[model samples]
Target chain A: MNTQAVKVIYKYEMLRAWNTILQSFASPVISTILYFVVFGSAIGSRIESVEGISYGAFIVPGLIMLALLTQSVSNASFGIYFPRFTGTMYETLSAPISFIEIVLGYVGAAATKSFIIGLIILVTAGFFVELKIAHPIWMLSFLILTCISFSLLGFIIGLWAESFEQLQLIPLLVITPLVFLGGSFYTIDMLPPAWQTVSLFNPVVYLVSGFRWSFYEVSDVSVELSLLMVLLFSVICLSIVWWMFKTGYRLKR
Target chain B: MSSIISVSNLSKVYDGGFRALNDISLDIKSGEILALLGPNGAGKTTLISVICGIVNASAGSVTVDGYDIVKDYRITRSMIGLVPQELTLSMFVSVWDTICFSRGLFGKKPNPLYLEQLLKDLSLWDKKDNDILTLSGGMKRRVLIAKALSHEPSILFLDEPTAGVDVELRKDMWVLVEKLRQTGVTIILTTHYIEEAEEIADRVGVINEGELIVVDDKEALKHKLGKRQMMIELEQTIESIPESLWTWSLELSGNGSRLTYTYDSYSEHTGIAELLRAVDKSGLLLKDVNTSQSSLEDIFIGLVKVNNEGSA
Candidate 1:
């Protein structure tokens, strides 16, 4: 994989990114805790078992995916966007650092932040309701893949964006809505056949299914298909990133 | 000596059809400080951007230290460090950390001694642990310079590096540049301020309306295009110019305290002595005589004005 370059960039950017996250740490942590109390304990009584699992247990994977997706986008977008807005990207581009190094640094940072957030939510979810992992390694794999995929997607969006408004457009107007409609809160099986068929089209569904599969040994879709989707998305994102760097797209030109 | 940077037929026509750099070409000698001077939109920044590979050139080829900028970008880029006009740093990072990170960007291993020396040179060693945002504007500018130098490149490009900096700090920067040049680090700088160029440039290149108007040695550029103005403070107020003084194209001050005469430095006869004799014959008392030579700024304006008139 020749990840030596990626690893160094990842380490430096991750350490610095964690420093940045410290600012929003208290807020997201408190907000997620409040979400558990309000939705898991307060609302769980009204809802019956979802696919034979408790409502609290069913929403846990969805909530973790939700947090992972948003944080990945925001962290990656802001990480690259601020430098571009402030004109520091000029310094970066002029340096000897290859384009691959830059992508690794920024995307790695975003992925790491999301991974940590996913873990925190996982541990937090465990406090409210006991979680039984059918395959812990698969769960971690899916989590890492999901984080890296979204982070790379966010990096592209950041580069393509010119202004602060443009940077926020993808995360707010596009990603948030897609995650919500990706069947995070309820099972697709409960929906009418047509709506469930539509829900399957959302790419986020694969991620949620993969994460949920690790927990209950059950999923809306086959685990192999979900993992394949993740790999496909990763390949597509990497190609786009590689093209942006090679052409010196928005960053250089 | 072999040229370090060879720019041939470089042109940058921005998306708006405004030609920022038009067919500009020059050979920058190894280890020389070449100053690019121009008015706003004269393509100084655009030129440097192309050479540093920061901005794409519409048409042209540049070779840095014999490596093609487009094909051998890694080697070319690694050879040059740029201190941009904008002072942008990772505001959250410490001064020392920022410099080290920049060094690592060039694939250079961390040399603690070199890093310490670079920090000490910029007087940033004292503030090494401080976050970038906490520093003053002058200090931030210094940090930018330090970051650019951290990679130990053979060539350095400074785009208005001293803009908004204090006079003392500006001098400090020049001194550092002088030291760097002595160490065989070729320097290229773009500045709207003429005095900065006059102070350090070995050769001066002027661009106007995206065209390279002239490139010459500092002394030669001044001598070739420079003009001198003779200011004759009159003894008393006068209502009109004397007919005999008309040949000199003299301009009389409204208050009659001064008479101005413009002459080419290259001309054999300035007509100054004859004009003085004419003044005496015309019975005008000359209170005082003072002479001033043209500056690079004057020459630059003169050249641009000539180009504009020719185009018109």
Candidate 2:
């Protein structure tokens, strides 16, 4: 429909997210640094090189995905949740803006935050270990795609949440565990063959592997498979979000 | 004026088995103020929400300026402005930013001059740069009004626009409302304060228990349903009412110094003469006579009570 309206919404929503970027910077950056300090310095000593890359550098991409995923989900979820909580959701729903416009605006903002966090973690990891970029464009593409996919997922979570506690549940309980068990600190190859097959089923594995492939040119999974998985997740999440808007689900209720 | 909003057989039944709005229907004319008056849980909010397209109707059709609410939602929503009752503003956003953002939400380009004028009119110009959280409750309420009017919709719905405001701000809001009305903006407001409707509404609609019980011109409804009371100060104290004045339906005060006679104003016969004759026949000299008329509040209470009793 109105592309200009969506752009305007995206611009302002991005600005709103930027306005609060500093508040999140302290915690997320500190967490990333701790990951680097503990995993790169302490854990890397005992764990030798895996897949010909240093343990410190091997975990960088996974850590970045972790940052991207959690920040993307939190920022987008809170972006929609606070508005609904404060009653500004009424203003948005009643606006001439379409559902795509609203989602794009919010997801764009969330993705931006995730990108910023991802960048911060990337820079932080560089201080501890040497980083390589095998395909800079693919890295950026996967970064954006993963951010958007999880942001859409977060947007849906925000709509379904009735209170602040419910809003915090997903990022704390669901995404954190998924990221931890998604081959962030250890490769799936380190697991038993059966566990490796099971880990292949974890969606975060594809995201982390795709990000790792972008950096070191080596991944537990194929880059093409990881890209396809990210694309598929993005499409499915986008469709569900679109359906929620069309049905006016919890957003209107 | 032609009708600007038409709602037919609108109803909303929640999954909890509560009928939030029952078969409600009403037509709002352009360039007029229609006050939806009701107590809490009377479906006033639900009616406004549905018409504004914020809530879906279970079974009904609503057309705003000939655009269906559901089928042509974008156009219909663009034509309507709703000032919700909740104090739900972005606390960190500046006042000017909030209004401009709201205007942008309607796909309107930024008009700094119009925004300046709107802020000035609402006495929010001085606080344009101030974050919304820094403003007092009254000023935040003003910002909410500013945001609602930012889009410049033709029809405005204010849900309890002045529920908990100081007298000065309420007066300012009423003045602003009058100015908006002067610009041919049709306003439909829901309020628990009957005096507000009595003061500004061209027509008043009363809803009770999810159903619209009455809709009439403010003064006309007052005249049609209003009751009158005549209090007479008796010259001498009486232990009880006199049988001679029983036909007058008079009641004696506890102190026996006053007599009150209640009568319907719309009745063809007021029976004041017959009551006076009987009072004289009873040898009770009236020391003083004072008359009082029912207000919109009285009429609303009476209508709601009658409707509830009838339904029960």
Candidate 3:
């Protein structure tokens, strides 16, 4: 329980976030605004309501979730990956810190950065559509949980990736498609029955559906199932990280 | 002095079945500078890595102050600081922040006064606010030293501390290392430069092909293994060795204008007087006589060559 070590690592990571203000903070905000402009104005004109909620407001939670997933993954993965790339990880590995503290520091900082971006996007969504949270506590919990879980996944990716190409491979080729197909802009109910069944298989659906439920009290899946899924994913990521540190995979050799 | 770090039967084999270390054992005394000299890929880094808890040993164990490096990692790690060979640093972080963070990572409470003095000692105080990316290679190396010392560890490992460094910085680093030695910090440094070991090390350990071939006090090793050469220049050339000097193993060179005699310096009877007397009695006109001692470099090359031949 080296709290000082954790704090030091966490603060250094956060400082790095500030140093790259444009990429860490501004990129997600601008992208979220653009989503609103394009989807709210172009798509909202034709589709007036989604499950009795205004079309513009219906996608807010999904958009925020989308930002949360990608930001958390990218931030955390790059946080760990850059250290490995620069060979500076030796410093941390040789320090008097445990693996848990190292994970806590890096994953904690990445999650915080993603959580802040999600909140900023949520506030910016207010400008385009009237927003309300039917269950604010659940919304906050889901946001925090999603940030943490995704950040852990990102940490694993950072450890597993050997090159920059591999680092971006999953986030772009896997996560972005899942987010888009998981109902970021529209509900799965609008899809054909067969496609709707397949959409349920995508893990992002559970995350977006659970997040959307907090906003409008309507979702593609039960909120309880989504919560269970997120917890399960978090546990899986934690186990892998534990095993990685124990075996010194890609870190020690 | 008691041994602060003890390694017993340590071995490391990489995933591909390449044995990087082979049953290496060593005991380092506290407050002495030990230099581990080896060629590239001689497992110098691997040995250091295992002791520092960065690389896991495949066999046996290492203990720092009697605490196991693996089971008691945190405790032992806190006692050691490593200046790695690679100049790895965060480009965006300021020098001050980097050192502070390194210290904190060791779970040490903030000691700004100590850090300030450390910066001053390394001559990095003026560039404390500047980002690491802006600093030159030499300055970055200095920062690495500052970072290693930030935790105030009793044992410090400097892995090639002066590799690729300029002559001036190398001299300054030697001075700083000596100063640190005076402060009672046990320093273990690995180097390919034999002069570095000869200049500052109290003990010298030679590792070749993943095995520690020799470890002895610097002066003792020099005296025991080093051979001296005596060169005698003659005013006139000779066609062959004089019968009077036949007992002495002397070789005529420079087209017979000079004679060289190799002898064990550590031996009580070098027989230099007898050889010179025999040469004078043989009627050889001596123009000049000089003696040269073998350096650590010569001894190292000889040892490595012999070991290679024996293994081959």
Instruction: Compare the candidates by lDDT and give the number of the best one.
Output: 3
Ranking by DockQ: 3, 2, 1
> What are the candidates' individual DockQ scores?
0.43, 0.60, 0.84
Model 1 / residue B289 / CA error / Å: 4.8
Report the poorest 10 consecutive residues by lDDT, candidate 1 chain B: B101-110
Model 1 misses residue A142 by how many Å?
Answer: 1.0
Between candidates 2 and 3, the lDDT winner: 3
* lDDT (10s digit) by residue, model 3, range A57-102: 9989989988999999999999999989999998888988888999
Q: Say which docking band candidate 3 falls in.
A: high
Give me the runs in candidate 3 sitting further than 4 Å from their true place: none
lDDT, candidate 2, B1-312, per-residue tens: 898999899999876789988998899999999999998999999899888778878998999999898889889888888899988898988998889888888877788998899999999999999999999999998998999899889999999999999889888888888999999999999998888898889999999999999999998998888889999898899998988888877888949989999998778999988888888888998899888999999999999999999999
Q: Give the alpha carbon lDDT tens digit for every residue of B226-268 in model 1.
A: 8889998888888888998899999988497788998886788
TM-score of chain B of 1: 0.92
Per-residue lDDT tens digits for candidate 3, residues B43-81, read: 999999999878889998899999999889999999999
> What tens digits encode model 2's per-residue C-alpha lDDT throughout A63-151?
88888899888888988888888888888888777888888788887888788888888888888999899999999999999989999
Please list the C-alpha lDDT of all candidates, in the order they appear.
0.86, 0.88, 0.94
lDDT of 1 by residue, A41-93 (tens): 89986889887899888888888888889888888887788888888888777
Best by TM-score: 3
DockQ of 1: 0.43
